[model samples]
Every structure is written in C-alpha cells, then in structure tokens.
Target chain A: MTALIAGAASTTFGKHDDLSARELFRDAAEAAIGLVSLTAVDIDAVYVGNFMGALTDDQGHMGALMADYLGIPDVPTATVESACASSGTAVSRAVDAIDAGQADVVLVGGVEMMYATGIAVITDALANAADNEYENEAGLTFPGIYALMAREYMNTYDVSEEDLAQVAVKNRRNGVSNPISQFQEEVTIEEVLEARPIAPPLGLFDCCPITDGASALIVVSPEFAANHGLSPDVRIAGRGQAGDTLALQDREDMGRTRAAERAAERAYTAAGIVPEDIDVCEVHDCFTIAELLAVESLGLCERGEGATLTTTGETAKEGRIPVNTSGGLIAKGHPVGATGVAQLVEIVKQLEGRHPNQVPDSAIGVTHNVGGSGASAVVHVLEVAG
Target chain B: MTASWYESFAAAVDREEPQYRRCAACGESGLPPRQTCPTCGEPEMIDAPLSMSATVVAATEIHVTTPKFEGEAPYTVVIAEFDENVRLTGQLSGNEDVRPGDGVTVGVERREDWPPVITFTPS
Candidate 1:
C-alpha cells in the first residue's frame, strides 16, 4: 500500500534566538501531531534527520533525545544522516517502513541548529560531507565546489554573472510573501551583481544563511490514515534516491549531477509522471547555482537551459512552472538537516491551499534534495488528492 | 609526527605512494581506500601513482576562505581528471586564468595548521 503524508509542520526557517534543538523539534512535532486526530502514542516509530547536532551543539543520539523529549521514549527510533539530504532520506525510510508493514504510522523529524557554532566549526562540520582525503584535504569548501560548477556552467553555456543574479532576484521576490523566509526583502539584479563575493562568481547573497529550525511530518499508510479520521491532501505517489562517488573528480560530467538524474528517473517512473506533470517543485538551492542545476537535473529543463529559464522568468511564481515557492534555501534559509522535510512541508501546504505563496491550479508537486555536492539525492513526487 | 602543513602533506604523499588499487572490473582508481569498487562493485583490483599530471576538468576562485584558513582568502580550487580516470580536487597554483582541459601537475604547499596540501600547478 502507498504511504500518505497526513500532516506536516515546520518552525520558521531562520535563525531563532531562543529555541533549542529539542524545543524546535517539539514545536514542529506538536504542530504536526496536533493536526491529526491521533496523538504521538499512535506513532509506531520515530525517525530524526540531523547532520551536525554533535559538533554544533555537542548533542548526539538525537533520536533518543528527541524521542525522550517528546514523551515517546519506547518507540523505535533511528537517526538518518545523508548530509543535507538527511531529512529527505528520513521521509524515504518512513515510506519504506509503512510499505513493509513494519509500522502503520511514523513520525519523521529533521532539525538543525547551526547558528550556535563558530564559522570555522561549521565549515569543518560541513566539510565532513566531502571526501576527507581528497576534497577537504585540498581545502575545498562547499562554496568552492559549487563555484567550480558555476564557472563551468558559465563557460560552457556563455551564461553571464547577470544571468546567475536573476535567480537570486527572482527567489527574493517570492520570499516577500513567505513569512518564514529569512530574506523577505526583494533584491534587484544590480544588488545581486554588487553583493560581496563569497566565491568569485558566487557572491555573499548567493549563499543561504546558517539557520536554526526543525520540520516534522506524519506519514501513514493510506488505509491507516483513513481509519484514523485523517484525510490527507497529499499522497506520496513516488520516491527515489541515488548515491554517487564522494569525489567530484570521479564523475564524468562536473556540471551535471548524475545522482539527481537517477533519483528523478526512478521517481518519475514510479509515479508514472513526467516533468510536465509537476506544477511546482521545492529543490535544493543551498546556493543560487544549485537551484539552476537542480532545474536541469530534475528534467524540468534541458542541460544548459537552467540559466535560460531563470533569465526568461519562466521559473517565477507566475510563470509556466513555479520553483521554490518556499523561497528556497537562498531566501527561506537552510538549516541543513531540516531543509528536506521543510521542502515537503512547503509542497504539502501548496497542495492544501494553505501556502502563503500558493501557485494557482497546482496539483502535482516534487521535492529534490541533494547531499554534499551530488553524492546523494532523493526525489519524491506527490499528488493532490481529489 | 610533526603537525606542520608540509609534514602533513608529506605524510599523505608517503601513505598514498604505493601499489594503488585500480578496480580491474570498473577501471576507476580507488583513492585513500575503499572496501569495494564504487563503479563496478567488484572486489578484484590491480595496483597502479595515479598520473602525477592531469587535465583540469573544472576550476573556481574562492573569494572567502574558511575562517580557520582565512589567511588563504582568494585561492583557486580545481578538479582535475587524472589519467587513471579518477578525479582529484585540489588547490590550483600559478596563473589565475586556469580553465577546463588545462594540464596541471600535483605539487605540495604548506598551510597554517596542516602540512603541505596537494596542490596543482598549470603544467
């Protein structure tokens, strides 16, 4: 039987001043669990996706911590960490558990509190996602990796820095209506162009901030959901994940993310849906350049056409296919582990007509989450129940 | 072992320079170490220095360094495809105009806390 996402919730995606990781998870979990007629007791298992609680907050065993804090200590719990795709992977696992009859209801939560750490600590923490002996040893930061891809994209496609800036400007505009977004102020093309460079081609504005937040979702089998007096508006029609070599140099194409393509293929095949079937999508846009690449990797557009779509405003909210209605990581803020689940939350809200930045006539939605450069990726397709 | 940057890289070089495993099944060179071949998933392998020279596949300039290495602000990192078909990512040295397909040779350079990192210089 297929799994249904009965409810979802997320803390505002930004740096929160007063919330602990436990508090953040509590808020999101409470909101999600409250939305359903069933309580936490009904959840047969709990999955937590957190990448850096150990180094950043000196907290490990996050699964037990959250389970205990939420008053569900006896439940089977596991922590899933696939770098930035942690929470998205958690969702995939939840679906599998339900399909295998291991659990009828599952609580999946993703949380990250990155702002508490120093910049150096965070950099090291993030670097752990790459090939330690190769990339990290060579002093390659995450921005540096994406910057290489951006430069290659620019050189191969004749895409100018101005074209890249358009992505930031467009997402910022979408952020205006997203109250949870860290950057609600709209940015002009000129501002993006003038923003201080973080990596030569990628400026400070091009990157997402280190955020502290959490997102929670309640996943149940369709029959289980219906039996519990819950009617889900979003059903998981398809889910897929793929992994590639940790080193970027190992891949045949530096500009393309093969893992994303593989995952998308499986997702589309499973759902019997094509790129055209998706009305909106929430993609991994930790950097502006990533958003561009995601467009192509997800098959929304052809290779080298991502920048073109952005330049033509085809990715804008009012355009043919809206992308990142949550304002994306660039504006919505990326809390790492929480980001993937947050993406699903945004898509669910859009389908249920509860999205603050809702796109008209939206039916099918997709979420793409990538872990560390393109080593891992998970894609999910959801349909709005009639 | 000394903790200096050059010493660290020297240690890395010494450790890496040996009968390296190239998955006979997949033809991809395994770096550091691997339990199974990533490409073909075969366990059998052959020993082969991944070419000391490689062609730059991609390059970028990091305007801001990690706070730990803030002194090295504005350095270039490049991914080079070694002759063995294994890609290696490292700092690119010499002219800032490095581009894809440019030939480069691996070199060692000292850093603040770590030893000489394996860097690349335009060949």
Candidate 2:
C-alpha cells in the first residue's frame, strides 16, 4: 500500500535478434530509472521476472545477471517465475517490500526472448508451464489447454466460432495504433475464421505469438517520493494473486477461471472500487477465449456473457468500457514473464491519460494477468493518486 | 517427488485398468493421482476400479502440435467424464466422430520410450 510507481518503460513486443535478455532488461531498466532521475545506486533491491531463460536463452540466475548487468550487482535480488505472471508477481513483491518497510526504492523488470527458440522447440518449452508428466505427455499444449475450455464454452452455451472471432477483430483494430504491438495490421472476422486451425475453435489468429520483449517499473515508498520531491499520480491501489489446479481435467467447471475470480474479488475489495468504476482496462488475452474468461472473472460482465458483451461492441475502445486498449496479449505480444508488468504499463498509461489510444477522463484502471491454463492469476487495480 | 502417490495410478495405466482415487473420508474421486484428497486433505484415498465406460464432455482436433506430438500431428484429444464420475483427458482412439454427450470407452496406449497415452473409443 505504500508503493508508488515512479517510472515505467518497455521494449517493443515482438522479434528481437539484436539484444540478449539481460540487455533487453537494461534498456527498460535504465529508462525507468531515468524517468525519475535516479541512478542504479538508489535502487535498494532488484526483482527480475523471467521464465524459460535456462531452457531457451541458455541463461539462468536471472536476478544476479540482470542486477549485475545494470551495475547494481550487490543488491538483494531474486528471480520470480509463475509462468507468464512472473513480472506481475515480481511487481507485487516489490510493493510488499515497501509496505513491509524493507526498501525505499526497488527496480522490477520482466524480460523473455522466445522468438529465437523456433516453433517446435519453443512449443515444448512453453508447455513446461503445464503438468509435464500428465498434460504435456498426453499431448496437451497451451493452445490445446485453452481450446479445451473453448470447446466446453461452446458446447455449454449458445456460442459459435464467429462470436469468439470478434475478440480478434476488436484487438487487431486496437493493435494498429500501438507501436509496440506485434501484430499491427488488422484482420477481419472472416480472416480469423478462415485462418488455419491450431486447435479446434482456436486458429492461428486466436493465439498469442511467441514474443521477445521486456518491461520495467520503479516502485518507491511514499517517503522516498516525498524526499526526492517527486509526486506520482499513479499508485498501485490494490492487488490480488491466486492459484488454481495446474491441469484442465482437475477443474470442476472448465468454463470458469476460479483463480481470476478470487484474485479480482480480493483486489476490488482492496482498491475500494467495483468493476463498474473501471474506466479503462487491460487483460491477459493469451487466447481469444482467455479474454472472455478474464472479463467474466473480473466482473466486467455476467458469467457466459463475455462473448455477448464483445458482440455488442461494449468491450471495444470506443464502447462503454475500453478493454485491451494495448492490444492485449493476443495482439500486444505475450513475453511470458513480461506480460504482467506490460499489462500494468498499459494501465498506468491510461491512468495518466497519455495512452496511444487514450480514453476520456480515465482515472481508474485494472490489469489481469494469468499464467498457463489459469494456474496463476494476478489482478492489480491502479488509481490516480491525489 | 514423493512419487509413491502416483505409483498405483501408473500401475493402473500400465495395466489398462480404469482406476481413480476416492477419498476414504469423503468419497470424492480424482484422477492424475495426488498425495492427498484435494477436497478434504484426506491421506487415505483408495484406488477404486471402474468399468471403463465414459461419455464425451469436450473434444478438440489439434492441428498445431508440440515437439513431442509434432511427429503424430492432427490427432483429436478428448476429455471423457467416465461413468465413475472422474474425468480423463486423452487422445480419441480410432476417432469415429464424437460430440459432447456421446458414449465412449476408455483405453490407454503404452509403449516403450513413450508415456502412457489415454485414448477413447466411441461406443
């Protein structure tokens, strides 16, 4: 509760052959530190959010690596990984340190370089987030995991493929304006439907691409901000993180995301704001069905009403509540560890009224980030501090 | 890995018997065995054998496969809610057109150098 976001920055989400993982973090880290006019020495600790560095990037011990790379090698540091929610959890940890009176300023950054791993190798690596002995061994993939939910969703509800395709249409339209987004060009629902199937009900267009990007945020104690004569309008109002069963077969209702619902409930109570109070939002749309599940879990709409909400154009930027204004993970790019921090970046931008696709008079925003198959979900509510 | 919990389930998979854990305390059934009952944290769970009959709950024909499944591309995966009230996710055996609510029989394909693959046949 005492943490205030001093600075935020991110590398463009997509292919990056020029920079290593540590280098990517450096760029974002230096920029974020510079945003509030501080050197690395001012940061009391470093929290790095990274996943799959050892398997794909041949780099492990990310905390020490990123800290040493940023010329702050001696600070206490740790690498946090909850699959894709790594950075989101990392940010939460930094805030906790501030609330616990451990540190004045903490540097949190998330980075992943997956584009170099290629499809075959990366596909298997990403599935490590699932239950490897059962789910992966049984041929279940990340897309397949989401596809299973999509199937149950369709069979139980009066939904069709066309209904899910609307998510891509709206997000792709939003991506066209986000320079950091991976897929800038828009695609029609016809293109979404006609696209080759990855898993039934989810096509190549429905899934998030393998991305290489990084995001960084400088979190400070209220006293530190005052001592430095820096007043931040954006503060983390409330945050909630929860877990669910790792595999899909274990879930009682495949249609619902229990972790997100629980996490959002805790966050809403913490922030003292309801879903209706949210002006702009960003969610982990790892798959099109994921966005629907997220909105329902976050209470944006009723259960089983996400697809209908999209069909009504209420989730679009110009609609009642602008969701995924940063193109979401579907279009913005999901660099696993960086996604949570990246979602926070988008939310902060909207709260600052400086977003590339800014909404009118937006003072409150929320970010929903979930790891593989809803096993890990973290929701944070950011508000403009007076 | 206290894999003793999984040994019975693995043995059942190897023998192709339909078995799942039932909490001795609460009678809740679970698959992909765990050390304790997920519902009540009961340590005494018995592996109740089943008749292998099941119904299709959901199915997806996967075109994009992982590195392991890449060699065996384009296979249908099914979540079958067995008659015993436990669900198993596996590949559809022989694929004779299955939709939700269709009756099916559970099977396991075990081979050397590969993990056990759960399969379902429409009945």
Candidate 3:
C-alpha cells in the first residue's frame, strides 16, 4: 500500500500579523482540500505539525482544534512536534496510516505563527529545541549553533566567507521567482559579506528569517485516489527519519549532520534510487551553512565539498543538481513546523511542471527536513506517478 | 531548577575548580551529570576534577543572544575537549581570539544577576 499526494497548497511564507497559527492553518488546509476538490467528508484523520504553539500561542491539543476548525471534529487527530521537523514528522505518520491500511485519506500539514511575538520570544522558544541545560544555558541560539558548524567547516575545508555567501546569493535569486517566498529580492556576495554579523562568520543574510505560514498536503492511498477518479500524479517513493544527540558538543563531528546522513541513506535504499536519480530537491537550508552541510549529508555532494558546489553554481536552480528551487528556508521563510510540508509542496509543483522556476524535466524529487541542529531528520523521496 | 549533571560542575565551579562526571562502570567521562551511564547500564558515577587545560574544538561569536543572555551579546562560545573524552561548553572570558584546537583553561565566572557559569580563557 503506497501513499500518494492528491493535493498540496501553502500560504505565503512571511509575517502574518493579523492571523494566528490556527487561522493560517485553516487557510492553507482549505486551499489544499479545494485543490483536490474534497470536502470535510473526504478526510478521515488530521495530523498537525506544530513546534511552538504551546509556547507562542498557548495552545495545545491542536489536532482536535484543527479538525474541528475544518468542520471534521469527529475525525481522529494527532499533533506531531519535532521542533523544525514537526510537519515532516507528521507527513511520515500520515503516510504510515495510509500505508498500513489504517486510513484511506488523511489531512497532514504544519502551521506556525511567530510574528505575533517579537524576536526575543521567538529566539527563546526556538532555543528549547537544543539542550536546555547544556547548550541553551550556555547562551547559544540556533544562529550561534550553526555558526559553530560554519566555522569548523571553513577551517576543515579551507573555505572562505565568500564561498558561503554564494549560498545566500543563490537561494535569494531562486526566491525571486517564488511568489510565496518571504524574500523575493536577490542578494550579492559582497552584500552578504558586508551584512551585520548575527554570529561571527555568519551575517544577517546567512540565517533564515523568522516567518509565519502554513502548508497542507492531502495524502491518500492509491486506491482512494483511484476510487475518487483523481489522478495520482505524485507518489511517496521513500521516507526515512533518524535521530542524533541533541547537543552539538556531545557529537564527535560538528561539520556533518549525522541524522541527515542516516535518514537520506534509508530513504535512498527504500526508494531504490541514488543521488543521481533525483532531478530536483528542497533541502533544509535553515542557515546558509546548513545548505552546505545538507547537500553533503544527503550524499548529493562529497564531504568538505558542499561549499565548493555552491561557489561553482552546481546547487543553483540552473545548476547541475538543482537544490532548493523554492528558495528554501533561507528565502522561503522557515515557519518551523510548516517547513517540511512546504518542501513537499514545492517538489510536487516541480514534478507537475507547474512551478514558476521549473527544473526542466524534473520527475524525481527529494525533501530533507531537520529538527534542531540536526538532532532529528526526515527525508522523503517523491516521483511522478505517470 | 538545577539539573542533575550541573550539580558537580556547578559545585566545583563555585569552589573555583571545574569537574566532570565519569560513569564508574563504563568509564565514560563528560559533564552535566547523567543518572545512568549511556554506554553501559550503570547508575554509579563519580565526579572528578577535569584537567584545567583543554583544546577548543569548535568556537563561535554570537552577536545576538537570547533574552536570558541579554547584554551578553557578541560573546564567544567554545566547545573544548579535555582528557580525550571529556567535552564541555563555556563562554570565553574576553573577546579573545579562539580557534579550533586552541588550548584553553576552564574556570568559573559569576555575572551580577546570572548564575555561575563556566568560563574559558586561552591557556
């Protein structure tokens, strides 16, 4: 039993001062269900991915609330939380329910509203993802954590700041074509280098902006899609999730994300596909340096060469192996929980040839979502169903 | 609320000598006390004074910090490994130049309103 995506939609990833996380989720879910031409009666269950709703919105039991808001209060509901990979984790669960014949169709998505609060609150909330006692207590935030990795990577690979700035420049360029992207303007290498340092060796442009958005995916078993006379254009080819030590100091290597490596390997084996088989990919570019590490950890490039790839334009939208054509979290805005589901939406659009910046002949795609400094990771492979 | 692992480190730091925990059964040495040995299912652990000097394996200068760390922005944080397996994180005493593999000495530092924290300085 394979799960196929029937429909996908996402709200623009940016500040939504007027909407709460629930309202954003509602908008995305309604639009997504509309895409499939489904009613509340069609959804059997709802899985909501949320990272900090409790802290930010003071809301929990989101599963029931979301289902109720969708006018399907009786449906079984569960809220998945894995920090940044919350929605990605939710997608995996939805796929499991359908694959095991437990459900025919499921509404799986992620939502986060961070603009209601200030950066101070959001930073503290995000810090909960790291080791509260060891890492966060040491006054390290996400930017500082990734900055550590960037520094080590630079020293190990003999890479320079300009090499990393290329990633920021490339993703921003891709974001220009994405109407839903938070930052549609492109940046230059010099500008990135000159940007105010958020964490030394990592400037303002190196980090993903705080965002508020929601994304939803309607997944159904192949039979369900067929019974409804709907074409299953995209199929879940492979899925994998892995975990690692929460604290970077506990890990032996900070240069690589072990969880991503493990997840990508499992996903590739399950899909019977290699890196070369992937035509397009949307990786977790939560940080510019993260983009570099993600490519290497996914085996899309060699270790210590991720920066080189960025510098040579290999990971650009027009490069040899296009990555993050949706502008990624860098320019796409990371709503944390919604990022995973949003990644899949971009991949599906590319495969359907409906993406604004289409990767020519993109048939196979991969999405990598990481939670909290690579402590957890989920990898999914998607392909055109023909 | 003080975490179990922080007890030994915090206590030692207050005494002006930093310490790390070693699982008595498996001989795994690190900081931030664990109730049980991660490598071996042993609950017995011992605290020992860590080597005053260590090597910085990773370092970063955080320009923006969390609310708890307000006014401490632009501080340098480093992960230093001591006695081969014992690794810990601390803020450098000053905006000193620190690099991977740079030798440093660990100690304790107290800020006006914050709790005692581990501090590292170039050895």
Candidate 4:
C-alpha cells in the first residue's frame, strides 16, 4: 500500500466575510481538487472533520453536505470529531483507507465556522468535548483544563509567567508573515503580559481565537498517482494517534501529555526517523503553554526546556528547530476541526518548497494535533522523496 | 447563566454564602466537590463546609480579560493546594499579594453568568 499526498489547500484562517460552513468546506475542496489530476467523481470517498457544525450552524451530517455540494453524491462520506484533532484523525482514516486497498483516492477536508456562534454557545460547544458528566458539569471549560496544566507546569518546572508570555509574542511574530493567519500584527511580550485575563495565568492573548476556515487534502496511493499521470510531492511516511481519558483529572500527571508522547513515538517508529531527523514541525499550540508542552512532548527539547527554548528564540523560524511556522493556533486562528488539516497543509507546502514562510530545504516535517487537554493526539510525519 | 448551585448551597449553609464538599474520608474540602480521595482514592467523600481561607500554591496576575469576565481585568489566579492533596484553582481574593505556599482561603465572588467562583483570600 503506497500512500502519498497529491495536493492540499486551505482558506485564509480568519473569520471570512460571507462563507457558510458548506461554502468554506467546498472552497477548500475545490482548491485541493483543482490541484490534483482527479476530479470529484474519481475520488472514492469524502471525510469531513468538524466538531461543532451542528451547534454552531445547525448543520450536521457534514460529510453528506460536502459530498453533495462537490457533486460526488454516491460516494461514501462521514464526519469525524475528536475535538481539535478531528481533521487530523480524518486524514489518518483516509490514509488507512488507501493503505487497506479500500480506496484509491480520497478527499479529506476539515472546516469550522465558529465566528457565527456567540461566546456562550461556543463555550458550550467546546465543552461538549470534555467529560460531560465529570468535567463539563463542574463548569470546567477548555481554558480551565489548560489552566490546570499551566499551573502544574509552572510549579514543577519553575516556568515563569514571563516565559509563557514569550510564547504568545513569538508565535504572533511568526504570524506576521503568514497571509492566512487571523492576526497579522506582531505582539510584544509586554503586551501579552498585560493582556486581559481569561483564566488565571492565561490572558486573552494566550488563548486562540475562535476562527472560521476550512482546509482540504487529496491523498492517493503512490501507485494510483503514477498510473493517473500525477506527481506526488510528499509521502505520508508516518501517522500515529492515541487517546487518553477525557477528564484531565484522570491523568496521573498533569504536566505531561501521555497521548502525545505515545503518538510521537509511534509516528517516529513508523517513519523510521528520530526527533532529530525532523527539520520542522506544526504542533497544536491552541494555547501558549500547549506549544511549550508540545515541544517537550515531541522530544524537540527535554522536559521543562520548552520555556527556555521560547525565551531564547530556539523555536523561532530561523532558530534551531522552527515550531509553528504557520503562526500556530495562536495567530493562525483555531477552527478546531480545521486545525489538524491546516497543520498538514502547511507542512505539505513546506515539503513541496511552496510555503511563503518556508523553512529552507525542509525535507522531513511532522505535525502534532491534540484534542481536549491532550485527551487525543495525532502525529504524522511526512517526507519529500524523489 | 445564573448561579444555581450558589443559591442552593448558600441556602443550605444558611450563611448567605457558598460552600464546598469535604472528603468525609480525609477531611479535605474544595468549592467543586471532589469525588474520591485524591491522595488515597477512597470513595468516602462527603460535603464539608469551607471558608474563604487558603494559601496560594502558585499565582499569576492576568491583565487581559475575556468578554465573559471583562470587568475583572488584572485579576489574580492561584492554584491553592489544601491539606490531603486536595487542590483548587481560582482567582485570588482581597489585595492580590499572593505567592506559592502562602496560606489563603476562599472568597465568594460572582462572575457574569455562573455562581460565585471560589476566589482565594490570603489566610
């Protein structure tokens, strides 16, 4: 089973002017399909990754909606939801389908139009990802869950508030060059430090904006691509996913994400590459502290070294190992379901040497997308092979 | 978004105030009830009344406030760990001079929609 990513595309990730949820998905799908040699009818199936279309737009059955709009009415379609990693999971499933010889070509898309919903509704929608009986019933929102981790990380690692603020400053600075990012302006550490507080130790700037966007990717077997007169830019060498307890309290350790560690390990093994082999990474930086933890969890840095890396510019675009070169969720905007696919879109561009904010000569790129305070993690490693 | 638990708990405690659950097994208490003994995993949890008294385990002052809690800018949030490993996190109460391991207590403060959060007051 030879699997390769033939094409990828995403809308600029801020709140769009007049796009509906279906339109957002359709536009991204069109962009991806246009780049590939195959038409909508050639695709075997459609997989949509969306978390809150039902509550946010009164639109469920997203798979059917996208397939119908794209004129692939008879193809099988399904929507996957695993919090923010929904699209990543969708991509994983598409890869599986091709690997299993079940599909020759698949269209994987992720979209979220969160701006249409109010704050309370959005909060409720996100809260649905948590343990309904345990965490959500107790008034624990997503921010509150990460807040607990931030506090624990600070206590155990002695990471200062200033260090966490540096993450927001750095990611926003990276966002400045990203045309699709929601925030184009660079922010200062001082500004981040002084921003209004959402949860304790986490300010408004520390949290990712409720973004509206969609991203799509065309995954085909390498054999199929060759037979169809298509060129493969990047090979999906490694993909791994792991799930943990939904409630943060269920974890034995608060500072570490076990699911991330396990997924990264499996991905590296499957790709036959070590962490040092990765030239670039697109991680789940839904929160500033999350980026810090991701660096550590992905083995880019040792535990407790993430803050130091951010503070010293090690994770900067030109630094030793550039993380979140796509502005991350911080400034890139997080349309939960769209985030994972967006990460892959950026990485594929980097591998294809097409990224505007390209990491010079990036050969091996990895993406890590997590859901609900690290309850679920999907890690995929991609490489450019001639 | 009114405080359903706040009014009922305050009425039960009969002090015009909110209360937390205490582990009948360990005597540890928090605003949001703990299900099992965090230290021992004992299921002998019971409702225990608590006062706004605790010490800050870790504290950071937040300047940016979200739309839901806009007026409370520059508020302090602290992770307050009590005896028996029962830890609670909330905004700091009183004059926000908080530090790790500083003794503190809980303070009843209303947010926009929910019941009063378990704010921390320096003990």
| Best candidate (score: DockQ) | 2
Candidate 1's error at B24, in angstroms? 2.8
Candidate 1 accuracy as lDDT: 0.85
lDDT by residue (tens digit), candidate 3, A1-386: 26899889999999898988778999999988998867978899999999998988999988899999989999999999999999999999999999888898899999998887888899999999998877876788899999988877887888888888888899999999999999999999899999999987899998999999999999998888888898968999999999988888887788889999999999999999999898999999998999989999889888999988888888888899999999999999999989999999999999999998899999999999999999999999999997
lDDT of 2 by residue, A215-323 (tens): 9999999999999998987999999999998888888799889999999999999999999999988998999999999999999998999999999999999999889
**Which residue pairs overlap in candidate 1's backbone?**
A249-B87, B5-B114, B5-B115, B5-B116, B6-B115, B6-B116
Task: Please give each candidate's TM-score.
Answer: 0.94, 0.97, 0.96, 0.82
* Predicted candidate 1 versus true structure: per-residue lDDT over B1-123, tens digit per residue: 343533544455546552346877867676545547877788876657556788988887777666656787678888877777667778877656787888988767766756456788898
TM-score of the second chain of model 1 compared to its true counterpart: 0.75
lDDT of 1 by residue, A251-348 (tens): 77777888999999999999999999899999999888898889999999999999989888889988888999889999998889999999999999
lDDT of 3: 0.89
Task: Give me the candidate number with maximum TM-score.
Answer: 2
The true-versus-predicted C-alpha distance at residue A13 of model 3, in Å, is: 0.9
DockQ scores of the candidates: 0.57, 0.72, 0.71, 0.15
Who is ahead in lDDT, 1 or 4? 1
Write the residue-wise lDDT of candidate 4 on A1-386 in tens digits. Answer: 25788889999898775889889899999999899877888999899999999888888999999999999989989998899999999999999899888898999989998887766678778877876534443345677678778987888997988999888888898899988899999988888888877766788888999899999999998778888988888988998899876666556567889899999999999999999999999999988999999999899999999999888888989988999998999999999999999999999989999887889999999999999899999999999967
Give lDDT tens digits, candidate 4, residues B5-32: 5446534434534356666766644345
Candidate 3 lDDT for residue A364:
94
lDDT string, candidate 2, B21-108, tens digits: 7888998887645658888999988877876778888888878778778868788888888766787787887848789999887777
Clashing pairs in 3: B5-B32, B5-B33
**Model 3, range B47-73, lDDT digits (tens) per residue?**
776778899988888888888888868
